[model samples]
Target: MASEAAATGSTNTGILGWIERSGNKLPDPVFLFFWLIGILIVISVIASLAGWAVQHPTELTEAGEPVVIAATSLLAAENIQRLWVDMPTTFTHFHPLGYVLVVMLGAGVAERAGLFGTAMRAGVRNAPTALLTPIVVLVGMLGNLAADAAYVVLIPLAGIIFHAAGRHPIAGIAASFAGVSGGFSANLLPGQLDALLFGITEASVETVFGDWTANIAGNWYFIAAMTFVFLPVIWFVTDRMIEPRLGKWNAEAAGNAMAEEQGDRPLTDGERMGLRWAGLAVLFVIGLWLLFTFGPGTPLIDEEATPEARLTPFYRSLVAGFFLLFLLAGWAYGKAAGVINDHRDLVKMMAGAMEDLAYYLVLAFAAAHFVAMFAWSNLGLVLAVNGADFLSSSGLPAWALLAAIILVSGLLNLFVGSASAKWALLAPVLVPMLMLLGISPEMATAAYRVGDSATNIITPLMVYFPLILIFCQRWQKDFGLGSLAATMLPYSIGLMLVGLALTIGWVALDLPLGPGASVFQEIPGTVNPVAPAAAQ
Candidate 1:
């Protein structure tokens, strides 16, 4: 044991080793927020004492000039009092908190009822062996809708599937990991992440463009495009590059222990019935949404409003619509599968889901305070204005500017792993700064996501990185952090390049990102806003 431990320690000594060491030394994400809050307080005090201030770019005073914003010390008497008195409200009102909890409340039921697992099994089990790579990769990409469930269920199961098919198990693990982590941003439909990140974007936009609203589907078409673009990349890389390198499946040499441990079990009758019901339930919900959207009364569309204004109701209802879709489908599946016996069983499933989120609740509390404090200090605005000025003076093309944002965001992902946390920090500066540069808030958000997701597979800081390494180790006992990072490096580099190219092309084409979302935000009275294509 000691010799094995020593060898493992030796492997973590170079660049990957340094990253692992440094990342491990840092505090957990929850405590990292507290540390940031503390640092921000001290900085606020210093900046306030130094009389640091800035001229607001857009907001004007009664005198019809740019408004001056001054730093406010977080430790000031009134500010300190507000923090203690409003702690609960601040945490609860955090934008992403409610959005995540509500969606999970329903998704949790689906997962606990075994709907996700059985569904994934059915999909992968039926794939022709010749197309297993793309099937696994595509499922992994769509699995983001299940959030963490994809990592826990699909990835390990993939290894077993590959082994059963007489293919390399590590290659299966690699393909699944590439889809789950590397393709984190690629999905056919939006889910909790869309709500979470856009909620933050809304808050940041309100800081500068007060009337601007966040559309959850702002990056819809781009991300949907990503799902298709990344599929072939994963297929090619796994089949031609990764699998070829892994050689062949040697059940005897690999001990075949893991294969036995995780038998390839086909779906039972009850599971099939449950899946049928779940499918019908999904279609039923879709029918209802469409009926309301286009039917005579048209509750989801405002008849008296402009075409753009008509989408507001539809966009706002998606959160609730998703909730009902998952809830009804899970309930239907659970009933048929015998996983849920009664209403109490359904309640129990939802409660169990919230239990898993206990850590997130704590993290959200800390993060909320940090974000609110940053806003109160005016530090975010000052930095955004200054940053915007610097970028504008550089005379870089808009596409190049967005590409730089994606690159910087990708680099930052290696250090900070939480998408919401990182976006909360960057949005205040990046969103507003980009808006000042003629880029819409949605466009800035789309850029951030491309960069944020491209490097997840390569970063040890990502929460699931260790978990993915453990999954790989099940196939090759010697697989360490460095080994996993090296395996995923190609996907990371390739995906980042693809993401950058997509962003550049999307901007150059002047396409609408989603319903009522444009590539540029027109300054009122200064220029006419570009009309977006009507939402379908």
Candidate 2:
């Protein structure tokens, strides 16, 4: 039956099909932004012409009247001068651009040297059959710390591992995909994503409060909780709902059973040795960061500042810390595995990493300009202030507002899968608007992640969606894109329901999202919530 369907089915249909069609019709994210820039310019002109204006939510005039702001046309002489003159500066100063490139610089070497694959394999190699799904799900979630390596390595390994364990290979694939992409933001540790999203958030926050900086770890605790909460959700859906429907595995019926074996192969002695060295590299990098933070001199600390402010430098150093950790670990593994013959080989791998990011560099250019022009036009501010006013007046509680953010973010994920690109677009409005309502940018970011992660698996527009579909077809042959979406639907719905509940519960509890990060924030242009003041 699976083979027959595989032979007959031609294209995607239903909701997934519509999404694929719509998304396909849209320009590439790079071009999408180029088009959006044009649209924004038109809107700015119209708004400027119509005399659209709003009272500054927080700014005050010298006489204490609310400062009124009118939209500035992007075509204004000054604006046009700024655009052409500052083009290079705008792209170079794009917030997430450096953070991603730096982190990936190290990650790419580690990937090339085979460290990420070995680690992922070691994670599930010997799990008991009863424990396989949970372990795979957990690893998939944890694998996020390794970035995109999880997608390229673990999911296929899972299919092979499951087949070797006598279960349906597709079940393994679904479970892995569910945890990896669907649970993209659920991790105990902050990685490149934290840097990327927070960089964008800081840019948004700066428009309202220039002195503010985003702590990349702002959503750490929330995402940590997300991991545990989502683990069982993926586990249950895969084992009970998805697997039963997939039925028992019959290799004969399985089409193109993936010219596979990496998962089945035992770690070579060299691989094991390399793993040990990489583990030590991680310890060394972490210990070095610890020394910088807590050892004598404490260059990463500022003695004259308040406690939170003192740790600001330390928080900022994590980005570099991650780069070193990956670079050293990858180099160590490559040396042990004989993959990197020398320093020149290391340079080549690092260069390859940036080469892979060419698309992101292009996308970032469009996004940076959009963000800059949006700030220049005063349109984001106008929208944020008025939007906040409407929401605050609507009388919905804070949790409902956040829940709405989650749903909207989830909806948007269906059309735009680049997390950084979308966050760069949304954060300008979402962050400042929520800040007006006494919600922190941290809380808003958390909500966006919850929505974004839960919907990743079900969305055909997600860049990796086609890859996941192909993985399914390798096992079942009959799995069309819709079939892939259908199999993953239960996992998506389960994750969404659970994720939403958790967000509401977190807000209700007023749990601190991370160290020095809270569910509420002092509105911009107002008092800071020092620990002592917060206690009072």
Candidate 3:
């Protein structure tokens, strides 16, 4: 795909060309994990033989002294036995796997029932032409709540809507892709990703601070802010930068006959009815959750707990809450839209959703093993301790360290496309290391998300990259990988810069990242050593 892009146009030459070529040669992400596991094993053996060890910064002996941790050789007889015996347990216990699968069970039903598609169409169709760009961008940003449905549904619909409005369809594709994939982490509401990533973050935090709890909405406010920040970036880049460069839409020249033929169709009576009911269903779900949260003897709040603990259940219930919301709304829309005649159809929709996750299940198995091995080797802790020591000695401003993390993560993203897999690998080291530097786990996670999402659009390895290209080809057959990359490069760069700036400013201002989440941590009897230096 990358080579096809490079060969098709001059727009993808230079750095874009190099990235495509290099990224295309990388192994499939699933295989890549197996290779990483092998490398990790070899490295563990070498480190163990070489007597590599670190002082456990957080864990102390009974005498109140720091403990020493030594590298455990993966080649050890006992370790090899445990690996064989615990293989199934490791895969099953993988955090992201369960979180994603559970959420998708509900999301899949919503998507397959036509609720997501109808909702997006309704949103875009109702917007005045003048507000189309921002509306499309906003819907695309919020579409993350539906997981992959946004990429498949919104990108193509944006193209058709633009063509009907006599604008460049490719520009619509650019705008939608920018919001859907490029600004992936930006959403007003927490979704499956929040649960999945925070699950990993919680695991990493527990490695250093055993009592820390996971909050799915740890970065909620920041991501909400990101949605607004990125909305303008996509709108301006699509309107002023990309569309002008492509010139006006040429109906005859542009091979988008199919799009032009379809034009803009008014929603059917059934769809309209379905949407109304779905809206009511959404409100009903929200009301139920509130009742559980704030009503007398609220089930979502623990009366016997401290004020902070009272909200923990509420926060944790959001995952199941969203599940019910999607499930009920989808069922309501399905019934009203005439897509579901009975309970059997709903069951089928749920089953179909699981069918689509077959590949992810396979990938998760390999990823789970790699993560388990990394933890067992104690290499993540050793690396975190050493890395934290290096950073502490360097005396770099905390913001600079965070900026560097975002940059590195963006660069690595060009090669590794799975957000969960990448986070699983990095969090073990980065989370604890930052914690040692007085940065909160949530802060480390926020910085990682900024970098992780910024370069998604330009990377061919992203699961949806080929799908986006296919969407583009519907408009211009000659539009190859390079064209897609070129079209999205500006958004990638702009959003990355904006995201980096947001991270730096958010840290400097010491704003709460989310409900009860902060940018810095205070260890008992120790000053917050990695506090951000005052802005110049």
TM-score of each: 0.93, 0.94, 0.93
Q: Count the backbone clashes (under 3 Å) in each candidate.
A: 0, 0, 1
Worst 10 residues of 2 by lDDT: 526-535
Candidate 1 deviant stretches above 4 angstroms:
1-10, 254-257, 524-536
Over 1-536, each residue of candidate 1 has an lDDT whose tens digit, in order, gives 32343355455767777776676677878888899899999998887877777677666779886667777899899889889999999888877787778888989999899888888778787789999999999999988988888888889889888887888888998999999888898998888789889888887876655666667888888889888888888898899888888787777655556756764677889999999999999999999999999987999998898976987888888878888888989999999999999999999999999999898888888888888888888877666666677777799988999999899999878888889878887887788778777898889988998999889998777877777777777777877777778888888888999899888999999998887888987632221111111211
lDDT of 1: 0.83
Over 4 Å off in model 2, which ranges?
A: 1-10, 61-65, 254-263, 525-536
Model 3 stretches astray by more than 4 angstroms: 1-13, 254-257, 260-264, 524-536
Residue 82 lDDT in candidate 3? 79
lDDT of 3 by residue, 165-205 (tens): 88898899899999999889999988889988987887776
Choose 2 or 3, whichever is better by lDDT. 2
* Angstrom error at residue 340, model 1: 0.9
| Best candidate (score: lDDT) | 2
Summarize candidate 2's per-residue lDDT along 306-371 as a digit string, tens digits.
Answer: 976898898778889889999999999999988999999999999999998888888899999999
Candidate 3 residue 102 C-alpha distance from true site, Å: 1.3
Each candidate: RMSD: 5.6, 5.3, 4.5
Ranking by lDDT: 2, 3, 1
